[model samples]
Target: MYPERFSNLPEYAFPRLRALLDHHDPGGEVVDMTIGEPKHPFPDWVPTVIADHSEEFGRYPPNDGTPALRGAIRDWVARRFGTTLEADSQIAAVNGTREALYNVGMALFPERKAGQVPLVLIPNPFYQVYMLAALSVAAEPMFVPATRATGYLPDYASLPPEVLNRVTAAYVCSPSNPQGAVASAAYWEELFTLAERHDFRILSDECYSEIYRDTPPPGALEIAARMGADPERVVLFESLSKRSNVPGLRSGFVAAGPRSMARIRQLRAYTGAPIPLPLQRVSERLWAEEDHVIANRALYAEKFAMADDLLGAVPGYASPEGGFFLWLPVPDGESAALRLWQEAGVRVLPGAYLSQTVAGENPGKEYIRVAMVAPKDKTARGLTSLRDCLYR
Candidate 1:
């Protein structure tokens, strides 16, 4: 009656959050920190850019991407990462990185590896799409803990050689979603080496790459180029969602080697919804403009400072290098979240929702993920409420 592969999948985090809290009345004004939706303003000119190209909406959009949009992405990559990409051969525009992230597993993961079902390595507390992507393709989604023990990045290289030999793809998120941990250059090198040794590909998710504190995090593409690694070894997915606060715009791209791009484009041609012409036009203008992104990053930087000032004294508080989440430790994630909602009306996500229980241990069991996407005053209020309610 149904695809059994997805039967055991836990409820998506947002629905699970509603089920956990919807019945209870908030004790105070509700300050939702559960979702990572950005409350900041996108560039003012984006609408104008879209309006100017609105006529193109009548035409079926280019499936892979418009040349102008691809060129804009290619140029931006060159400027931002110091790696030149062939717009036509190495890039394919996706509605958002989420879709690309999912489809990529389908397009790239082999039917079998080493005469066994392929393995898709995923960070334990990951973007939910990564797991679904693996499962949809019948690859065994292997969860490796990306906990404090491993510096908040998955230690893929630590896996046994037998397991590594079966890996067809490994997903790595820089400035990770829940943890906000950035992969170091050395970390990238080590992972890249492992991929090479094991003959697996790297699906590098850098959607949150633009939102960070201090130095810009090193990108996998640049690191791969530096190491003289196979171009096909690394495929990067980034979006304007977090970078420009345009999640609704659904604009992003997947960049990889020519051969990989061919497979991705082929899969996308059959089933992908191309970015609308007007939106692609807007994306082109947005990619060329950095003033907006810089301003957006500055706003996140302020929040990072606020988080550190408030929570740094807590025993396990470690300020994230990038991204908009505060992965704060508590005695128990679900209990702390319920307490925050019931006592303080601050809605935050239970970290356990984002991770799986493997062999009776869930890495996220002891923490809650708080999003800093709200405006400063509201974010401060939420953090103060949660801190006083739980950490105090």
Candidate 2:
């Protein structure tokens, strides 16, 4: 007699992975590559900053964010995205990208669109929060495929006009989770165009924006500004987790147009747990510095090369362009994952866990997502074993 909105939801990705593999004995030394948690080291100065601001924890944190923290975020956006945003009016510091993402759906999606049940568009193999957020508001969720056929980004433009007309929002992740495929500038232009024509909003999750191989992924806010689209069209989310190796800090920010941002802040006021002031201070400094991020990116680049050296010859294997996950093709995701665990002691998440089975096809059924978040040597060993075990 509880709400059924999320009752039918499948088990979340990691738990499903645990259920699938935990009972097996490892055939070799275990090299876990399942979760995308950053293993890189954060800056040494972070602790000092946190300690200096520790006393502030005695006081209630600002609901939106401290002006100084918001200013730093605003500056980072301008520096990274080349678009200026008013810290006070447009930016809301969030606990993390997950909270920001869910709240976007809660605050922005109306109960009805054109006098009908609204549709909230989500990528098929997407961050779980996006779908959960839609369900939280009772919106009709539409799972669009982000398969390799569509360059691993959802083809929202291909949907029928009737479907488009009812869309209240579409969630897009660039340097997408699982696939690590990035959206190009042209892609952003077309998406913004579609949003404008369809009269819907775009939730652009850019948490992995800072982790790339060569070119930085084009940002939603920057692209919107470039096109002179409505400031409200693209709601942007970013986090310091990957950028600063501070997932534990759980500091991120959401930016949108004045109206939409106001709604987001209002909703957060009641339910959101503000980032501890000390961590916010740590975040301020983290945003202002990029040395650690550059070093971290270089480390990822080195590991990706290791993966390429090991698995480059495997058919259908393309190294990720950004972020830290490898979506390797398999005959059957769960089967491959079990074999990898029991036979090779290499852990990975089956693609089915991250995707919906639509019309009998789970988009991720033939894939296993391996996180390259371990140390370089460990990553090399895991990739080598993965290649030897699966692709050899």
Candidate 3:
């Protein structure tokens, strides 16, 4: 018998999209704008670095992370966020932040909070893993809406006092996945303050932090440091996938307080898949270099501009402040997506698929998420077709 924990889970996003669209023939040359895989070139030197360390792969890699790799991550955090973190005590590496994002809940959430079943807070239309993580721990998974009215960030403070008291942790995505709304310094402050009052940890997913419009989004770690908040109060997950265009490498780091780090590392020793040493070596070098990341950001900036030029006049079209997805409004997400596929040959994800329906209302019911990971010209073509097909 299957475990009941995941029985209520909806079909995953891509498979659901495939079932919806694959049966129909494309009216034009098909353009896939559904997934967020980066199409831009990663640095050419990456293979050479991996080759140089290839022999090391024969040895079982450290379950946490190599000292050099962790040091590089520590230095990058210092440079990017201006917060000091000890590589040995405060950081643990994983095979992408997705793994850490899921496993952290298993490692940290207590059986009870305030003598009640713990609650794990999540933003609606969020990365699906957050809710699953909450469920793995048997915590009551609470969905807080991050709609236009709320600046596309969840407002945990709005929850009742009893609910807040039972919260063990919250998952927040800055420069959020589908909408691309970034959390400001003030937003982080407010959320951290709420966490302080509620006595819950904050999981800050900042994978898209490197891909923004004009300014680098302020991070929770830096904000917490500035406020002199407890270091254990905030845990950050960052990746080389979005930043360095190396999703296949599956290398990222998680930083937390000493006690939490120990727990995370201990958990890793038992069941975690550590990144291969050769790949870890490559990630270390990538984190040290800034030129490649700058160039990558510029490419996305051009695409963002193209999306605006094509869809700007469309009603309810809002440009994403960061990340590469456009959460475009439509009359109905599924209907619009089907029409886009059959008529314009553009594949997009229905927003409702990423969100949970609560009280008979799905926050993403009226939207489709379009990825801008294609090349500039291809992305432009898809955007224009989408605009013509859906809006006009």
Candidate 4:
């Protein structure tokens, strides 16, 4: 009975990779580049802070978040975006943005919209949680193509009136995963305009906000505030995983208007695994500090520059403006991945694993997503092997 809900979902990305290539022995020393897990060092001070607050682990953490943690998030938001927010009413510290992303659909999605089955707009080649979240709420998920043709971001404004009218929410990933497309300020404004016209909400995922170059990616909340849009229009999710190199820390946050936050916190009261208090204490420190995040971004920047130096001359190679991934064009993602693994022992993810097949074609079928998350030397070796084996 339980299987029916998620029965339509495809096999997840990693397992699919295993099925495709695990049976074969490595052609050379394995150069794993498939998973997006960061290999950089986290703040050395993190453990000290956690140890100092270890006693708090005995107590149950706040359902949403501790006052200090939420306040730190608010301060970070203000400092980073120049937009002030109410920590008490508008923010909730989540285990990670992944959990918050999934639960937002549960907490905020309406049973019906415009007297019809509500639709959730998801970018194709998306973070997988967005689709699962939509399905959890029984909303029909519309996979909008975010391919090379669309500038690697979905053009939601182009959707027909029928589709727009039924949209309960839309998930947007700035510095989007796998593809590394960063949404611009004008893009956010256009999205806000569309939402205002259609009365749908925007779920903006900006976990990679800090992993950029000269210009920081414009956030939905910042743009919405500039336009003075409804406070309830955008739900923002962010994380310290990429920003602070603490994926295992499983710490992130969600911010929304009072009404939406209330719903989120209420649902969280029942289903949330509130972060352990010690971890919350550590998270408070992580969100407030900037030096470590800056250092972390510099490390990624170095790796990105390396990717450009190596792959810049290759056709269809675009140095990501933000985020640490290369969405390289290939004859077929699955086939290229297989060849790379067998011929050079370089592991990479097929872009098709991250996207849905809609209509007749999978938009990612012609591309492969390479994560530049390994150490400098290892990443250099992997990229060289990949270029030699595939591009050559």
Candidate 5:
């Protein structure tokens, strides 16, 4: 029997998009700008390193990750974020950040809270996993709007007392998917304070932490350390998919306060799928090196500049602070997506697909998410076609 918790769940995004636009034929050559898959070149040495470690694949991989991989992650965290963590005690590797993100809900959410159903606070127009994770635990999933009026960041501090009382966890994405909004230091401070006050865990999704135009985005663990907040209140999930252009590598890690790490590790010990041994070796190398990441960031910066040059002058065009998406404003995201596909052959996701309807309104209805992960020339052409076919 299907779980009652998922009964009201909205249709998954891609199928909904297919239903919305499948009848129409493209007016021009198709250009897909919907998904946030990275298109940059991966490091040349990665394959060789993975192949070198191929002999280890016959053995079951360690749930806590190999010491070498863990040390590399620890060193990378220290170098990148200036936060020190013991490789053995405070971090655990997962197949990818998505698995870590989803499983955290299973590991932490309580059966009941304050004599009521527990709440899992998630940003509207958030990663779909956040909501599903909450539902999987039978927690009430609260969608907080992250609209332009709120600087594209949810104002969790303003939530009603009842909601706050029941909240057991909150999922926040920095360099947020679809919006590309990076959380500032002040934002982190506020969230940290709120988590402390409300007694809820903060799961920070920072997979897009490396791709930025101007400055590096501040990480949740870094900010938590700087604030001297309760260490266990925050957990961070990071990935090599976006950072190293190795999505198929399926390498990511979760770092948390020791107590949280213990719980997550305990749960993962039985159910978690560890990244394969060879890929872990590749991830170790990828995290320790910065040259390839810097080059990839520069490529994205160029794309951001190209997008600005093409679409910046348009009304309601707000450039993203970090990451590789452009959340372009339109009259209606579904209609604009269909129009772009039918007229310009540019495939983009309707903002509505990424958001839930609340109070009879879908916050993402008037926008569309454009991924800038294609090659420079192709991305430029796609953006120009989108601009002329939709904006003009």
Candidate 6:
């Protein structure tokens, strides 16, 4: 039977966007900036690598991941975050970060906590999967507002004692989706402290960890290592999607405390979908190399510069520090989205669609998330159109 908790879940972003704008013909040429699908060119050698290892695909892949892939991830974690993890002991491979993220709730959240219904704290305007994961685990999904006042990150510390007491897990996105806010090392420390105080697990989604403007954003694992925090209290999820422009590869990894990793591996042994062997080979190569990531970051940096130069003059423009989205404040997100489609022919996701109504107010109601994941010229054109039609 379907669960009642998810009965009222809002429709996903894209279908709702289609329902909102598909019927209306664009007044000008259409420029879609709604989804964060990467449009960059992946490494040329990727095809060759995959083809060379294609024969391995005939065999079933290991749920715990291969030594080479895990070791590569270990090295990547060390080089990027200055944190070390044992390849076989602390890490496990998954088909993608999305799957791992969902499964974590399944594997960790207990049926009851302190004789009370469990709670899952998630940031509003968050990745939709967080809410789904909570629902699947029968945990009360607590939507914490992540607004500009709070630096665009959720303030779980401000939660009431009762709410905090029941929290089983909390999902945090760095280089956050829609808003593109990067959580700092200080932020991670505070979160880790909160988890320690309340005795809950922290799921850090660092899928966009490699995409940044200035200095690289500090990661949760790095912060944990620095503080010598309880390793079991935190798990970091990462992917090669944005970092390597290999979303179709469907490969990612999770690094957790040894105990947590053991549980996750046990649960995955029965119900997990592992990455294919051939793609695992590709992932090993991707994680071992950073040249492509550097080039990808350069392209995004250029787009960010172009966006700043073009939209900086507009009122209420906040430049994103990391990730590839611009969360632009407009008069009304739904109206602005429709107006943009019908008048400017620019397609961007209405921020309202990404958030839930809390305390009779939707925090994302007045913003639109514009993805900077297009070619340079088209991105500029879309930004210019967005400016001329909506902000002008």
RMSD of each: 0.8, 0.8, 0.8, 0.9, 1.0, 1.0
- Of candidate 5, the 10-residue stretch with the lowest lDDT total is 26-35
Write one digit per residue (lDDT tens) for candidate 2, span 46-144: 999999989998989997889999999999999998999999899999998899998888899999999998999999898898888989899989999
lDDT tens string, model 1, 250-336? 999999999999999999989999999999999988889999999999999988898888888999999999999999999999988
TM-score per candidate, in order? Answer: 0.99, 0.99, 0.99, 0.98, 0.98, 0.98
1-392 per-residue lDDT for model 5 (tens digits): 99988888889899998888888998888888988899999999988998899998998888879999999999999998999998998999899888998999989889899999999999999999999899998889999999998889888999988789899999999999889899999999999988988899999999999998888999998999999988799899999999999988889999998988999999999899988888888888898999999999999999998898999898989899888899999999999999999998899999999999999999999999999999999999899999999877
Residue-pair clashes per prediction, in order, are 1, 0, 0, 0, 0, 0
| Residues 331-379 of candidate 4: C-alpha lDDT, one tens digit per residue | 9999999999999999999999999999888988999989899899999
Give, for candidate 4, the lowest lDDT window spanning 10 residues.
Answer: 1-10
After superposition, which runs of candidate 5 have C-alpha atoms over 4 Å from their true positions? Answer: none
- Poorest 10 consecutive residues of model 1 by lDDT? 383-392
- The weakest ten consecutive residues by lDDT in model 3 span 1-10
The collision pairs in model 4 are none
The weakest ten consecutive residues by lDDT in model 2 span 1-10
Comparison by TM-score, 1 against 6, better one: 1
User: Residue 45 of candidate 4: its Cα lDDT?
Assistant: 90
Q: 59-101 in candidate 6: lDDT tens per residue? A: 9988878999999999999999899899988999889899999
Q: After superposition, how far is residue 252 of candidate 6 from its true place, in Å?
A: 0.9
Better of 2 and 3 by lDDT: 3
lDDT value for model 3: 0.93
